[model samples]
Target: MMTKFKRLALAAAFGTAVATSALAHSSKETTSPADGSTVAQPPEAIVMTFDAPMRITLIQVTGKDGTNYPVTRTDNMAPSKTFQAVPAALPDGSYTVNWRGLAEDGHAMDGSFTFSVGN
Candidate 1:
């Protein structure tokens, strides 16, 4: 049995613990160059960075028309805090980068983003 005052204290402690745990969970904090950025020259590679370390298994870049870009290189710079992939110079028009990875907590993350190349 618990009194009203005791119940309130227990509730507050539980809430604080939950909130702290949630904050500790791995999440995407930032991305280099930002999500949607226009570059004057074609980028030598495509990189998607995250806050927590991720196990990136696959990454693909495709032209606006859906043609897969030639992947020249792919590297996991830091498996604990970042995931990156590099490719040759892309052609003009819009391009999309599709990535699949496992978060530090073992959860899978899959998403895509598009950017432009030239005039």
Candidate 2:
């Protein structure tokens, strides 16, 4: 009941679905500061943990008003789990995290999310 073209299309769709399912992130992973946690006191650093190893290159924090937060003097980035940058003490305000890293499969990935400091 299926033409040759139809069969090929179905096979391709099935393959893509399997691949996407295989790459799904597991609960064992984490993102730094955990996507919307407020800090009581500016911690000594900003850190991110991944569900899997990652090769990160650029990590930045920007305020909602468009000011670039100073990465603390400590390097907040690591080759596998986190990206370190020296950010000065983050004042009480809302800030956004912008980051770029290489996924375990070797593809470059990037994302942004915002977090608020004190209430």
Candidate 3:
């Protein structure tokens, strides 16, 4: 036997909770070489920018022919809004950068971006 005011209050509380949860997830804001972009030369470094601080746990770069390229992380696994890694000299090809991280809210997040190097 809930009163009208109590029902309204409950609905409001639920809505607020939903909104907060949605906002808690951190997301990638941008990347170096830019997602789906073409570069004239090999990029010196791989970079990611997030809307919130994120602890980057793993990152890998793979070529179109199933070749894996190693990258040296500059962040040392520390939480940061911007993460960077230096890649070895890359040949002309399409590459995908896959990454996994822990968000400030204690959620695991993963994403991928693609770029091509060519004239």
Candidate 4:
């Protein structure tokens, strides 16, 4: 038979483990120009919002024929809940945004999405 105090302690430990696991991987909440949508004009910067704060380790925007676009961070040192990158003028073509980052929970996460610039 388990004592009341032991049961309470077990419950608390379980809750903490569940919460930590829930935040193990951060996910993208939104993006500038969005994913899989066409835009008339090229966006000066690509911004990404995550469910939790993160440090962006790498970001890249690539176009067709394996062409890589220039990307720079708005802030270099600090981790943020939001991340942004400036890309060179994207000509009419399909492009993919690829990124890798560390979540606040210390997990390494990565994601990529595609979009079109024009017809």
lDDT minimum window of 10 residues, candidate 2: 24-33
- For candidate 4, the TM-score is 0.81
The parts of candidate 1 lying over 4 Å away from their true place are 29-33, 70-78
Which runs of model 4 end up more than 4 angstroms from their true locations? 1-20
* Candidate order, lDDT descending: 3, 4, 1, 2
Candidate 1 structure, TM-score to reference = 0.71
Tens digit of per-residue lDDT, candidate 3, span 1-119? 99999999999999999999988899999999899999999999999999999999999999999999999886878999999999989999999999999999999999999999996
- Comparing 1 and 4 by lDDT, which wins? 4
Candidate 2 residue lDDT tens string, 5-62: 9999999999999899677532224555667778766555666666776666677888
lDDT of 1 by residue, 1-119 (tens): 99999999999999999888666646665554356666667776666667788777777888878788866544532355665556667766777777777777777778777677775
lDDT of 2: 0.69
Question: How does residue 108 of candidate 3 score in lDDT?
Answer: 96
When superposed on Cα atoms, how far off is each prediction in RMSD?
2.9, 4.3, 1.3, 3.0
Cα lDDT tens digits for candidate 4, 26-45: 78999887999888889888
> What's model 4's lDDT at 70?
91
Alpha-carbon TM-score of each model against the true structure: 0.71, 0.68, 0.92, 0.81
If both were scored by lDDT, which would come out higher, candidate 2 or candidate 4? 4
Error of 1 at 42 (Å): 2.8
| Runs with alpha carbons beyond 4 Å of true place in candidate 3 | none
